[model samples]
Target: MTAAFVAGVGMTKFEKPGKREWDYPDMARESGTAALADAGLEYGQVEAAYVGYVYGDSTAGQRAVYELGLTGIPVVNVNNNCSTGSTALYLATQAVRSGQVDVALALGFEKMLPGALAAGYEDRESPLLRHLLALAELEEFAMPAAPYMFGAAGREHMRRFGSTPEQFARIAEKNHRHSAANPYAQFQDIYSLEQIQAAPMIYDPLTKLQCSPPSEGSAAAIVVSERFLDANGLRDRAVEIVGQSMVTDLASTFEAKSAITLVGADMSATAARQVYAQAGITPDQIDVIELHDCFSTNELLTYEALGLCEEGQGSTLVDADATTFGGQVVVNPSGGLISKGHPLGATGLAQCAELTWQLRGTAGDRQVQGATLALQHNIGLGGAAVVTAYRPAS
Candidate 1:
C-alpha cells in the first residue's frame, strides 16, 4: 500500500457556543487557512476534501469548504457522531494511501448548541431508540443516556474490578492540569481531585467536570502521498500515517449486555489492535497519545483497551502516574475532550493536529519529550472507533 503523511494540522481555540460572532464558515476559513499555511501550500493544490460536522444540514461540508476556495474538488460530507472528524481523517488517509489523490484535505468543525447532546430529529426513529430499549433491559437507564451509559460502565468496572470514583476523578484532574498548557483547550483552570469529585454529579461516579461540554471549534489536516511530499519539499515536516483502522460495534455490544461494550470499549480495543498490527508497532512504542476522553471514565477504560496496561489495571496505571508527563507514556497531552472540549466533528481532527505537533517537537509547553511514535483514538457512541498511528517521515 502507498504511504500517506500528515504534512500540516491546524485548530481553532475551542469556545462556548454563541460566545463570539463567528459562524462555522469563519471557523472553516480560520483553521483551514492555518493548516494550508502550515503546509506551505495553496488551496488549489488540494485534490479532494473530506469535511465533517454533526449539527448542520445537508451540504454543510460544501459551504464550509467554499470558505477555503471555490476549487471544484470532490467534497465529501462525513458524520459519524462524535467520531465525525476522525472519520474524515480516516477517509483522507485512505485517499492518499490508495493513490486516489496525491493531496487530500481533512477538515472538521462544529458550531454546537450549548448543554448536553440530544438527538435533533425526535420525531424520526432515532438510531439510539432501540439502543435505549436494549440498555434498559441490560442495565438501569438511571440517568441521561450518555452519562448513565458511561457511568454504568464505570460502576461495572468497580463491581467487577476494583476501580474507584476517586480514581476516575483523578483522571479528570490530570486532564485539567494538562489543559493549563494548551491554548486550544476550552477549560484550562486546574482542578484538584477533590474539586473534580465535588463538582455537580452528572451520574453516580461521573461529575459535571468529567463530562465534555458542547463546544464550537474547527480543525484541519493536510494528507499527502510520499510523492507529493517529496515534490513539495514537505518531507522534513511530514508525519507518516504508518497504520490506521476504524472499527464498529461488535457482537458483544448488545449480545453480551454490558455497559462497557455498549459504550465502545470493545470497538476501541479492536481498532487499536488492528492499527498496531498493521503498523508493526506496539503500545510500548507509542511515546504519546491523543485519545477520546469524552469522559474521564472512558479515558481509564481506554487505558486497558489500548493495551497500555492489563485489564482491570487502569486504576493502577492512574495511581502510578504512568499516563502523565514523566510517566510510562504521555496520554492526552492536549487535555483530551474532557478539558479540551468536544466539538464532535472537530474533536478527532484536533487530536490529529495535537499529535502532529508533538511528533514534530513543536507542541511548545506541552511537548512530549522524545516522542517518536504517536497514537490517536477517537470513538463515537453509536459505534465507531478510529485508531491511527503516526511517526515522523524522517
Candidate 2:
C-alpha cells in the first residue's frame, strides 16, 4: 500500500462546556474547520469523513457534518473506547493509501458525564458483566473503573519495579507544569510534586492528581494521498505517516496474568515493532512520543513496552529526566491525558495532533527541538493497542 500523509490537524482547548452549552456536533464542526484551515484547503475538498465517538448515539457524524454543510460524502462513525480516534484515522489513512480517496477527514469528539462507570453491554444483567465483575474483584479490590484500574497497575509497578508513589506523583507534577504552557490544555495550573501526592487518594496509590479528569473536547485531522499532497503543493509541510499497526488481547481475563506481564504491553510492543520496521527507524531515532498516559504508571510502563528503555528501567529513565521536554526523548509535551484532559474518543486524535505540531516545529513553548521523528500510541478496551510512527517531510 502507498504511504499516507497527514495534511493538517486541529483541536480545541480541553475544557468542560457549560450545561446545555456546546454539544458534540459543535465541537466536531469547530475542530473540522480548524483542521481544514490548517491544511490550507476548503471543506468542500474533503472526499470522505470518519468520526470517532463512544457515547454519542446514531447520526452523530451526520449531525456534525451537517453543521459544516453536507457534501453527501461517505461518513463513517467509529467507536473503540479510548482508541476511537486513532482507529478512525487508521481507516481514513487506509482509504487514501488504497487510492479510494484523495483526501479524507478523521474527527473525534466526546462530551463525558462525570459519574460511576457503566458497562456498555446491551443487558445490564448480562452474564458478561457478571464474569467481568468477578474477575475485577478477584485480583483488584474494586471493579475495573478506569482510574482505579490504572491505580492497581501503579500499585503493581511499585511492588515489582520499586517504583515509588512519589515518582508517579512526579510524573503528574511534570505534566501539569507542561500543561501550564499549553493554552489548549484543560488543566493549565502547575502542581507541585507534594501537591500531587497530597491530593485525595482515589484508589490506593493513585491520587486524584494522577487521574485524568473527565473532559469534553474534540480533535480532527486530514489525511491525503502522496499524489494529492504533491498536486496541492503541501508536500513540504505535510507530516509523513510512516507506519501504523494495531493489536488486541483478552481483556476480561487480564487479571489472570501476572502484574508484571501486561498483555497490553506485549500487544503494543508488537505493533510498535511493525511500525518501526516499516519506518526503518529504531526507538532511539524517535525524538518525541505521545503515549496513553491515562495514569502516570501507564506512561512509565509504556516507556519499556515501546522499547524506549529496558524492562524495569522505565522509572530510571523518568528519574534521569530522559523523557522531559528537552530530554533525550520528549514524552507527552502536550501534557498527555494526565493534564491535557481525556475526552475518550478525542484523546487519540489529540495525541496525533500534538505529534504533528511537534514534527512541524510548531508546538510553541512545549515544542521539542528538531523533532524529526515522532510516535503516537493508543490503547483500547479489552487490552487493544495501536502505534503509529511519523516523520517530518524533507
Best by lDDT: 1
Superposed on all Cα atoms, model 2 deviates from the true structure by an RMSD in Å of 2.3
lDDT by candidate, in order shown: 0.92, 0.82
Clashing residue pairs in candidate 1, if any? none
Runs of candidate 1 exceeding 4 Å displacement? none
Off by over 4 Å in 2: 17-20, 120-138, 250-256, 260-263
Question: Mind giving the per-residue lDDT tens digits that candidate 1 earns over 1-394?
Answer: 6999999899999998888789999999999999999999999999999999999999999999999999899999999999999999999999998899999999999998888887788678877666677778767777578888888889989998999999999999999999999999998999988899889999889999998888999999999999999988999988999989999989888887887888889999999999999999989888999999888999999999999988899999999999999999999998899999999999999999999999999999999999999999999988799999999999
lDDT by residue (tens digit), candidate 2, 1-394 = 7779999998888885453378888898889889999999988899999999887888797787677667899999988878898988998999999999999999999888875445667645642343345436535557436665666667777887898888888888888888887888988988888899999888877888887887889999999999889889998778999999887764524554544334256777788888999888899999999998888878887898899988888889878888896688988888988899888889989999999998988889898998899999998756568899999765
TM-score of each: 0.99, 0.94
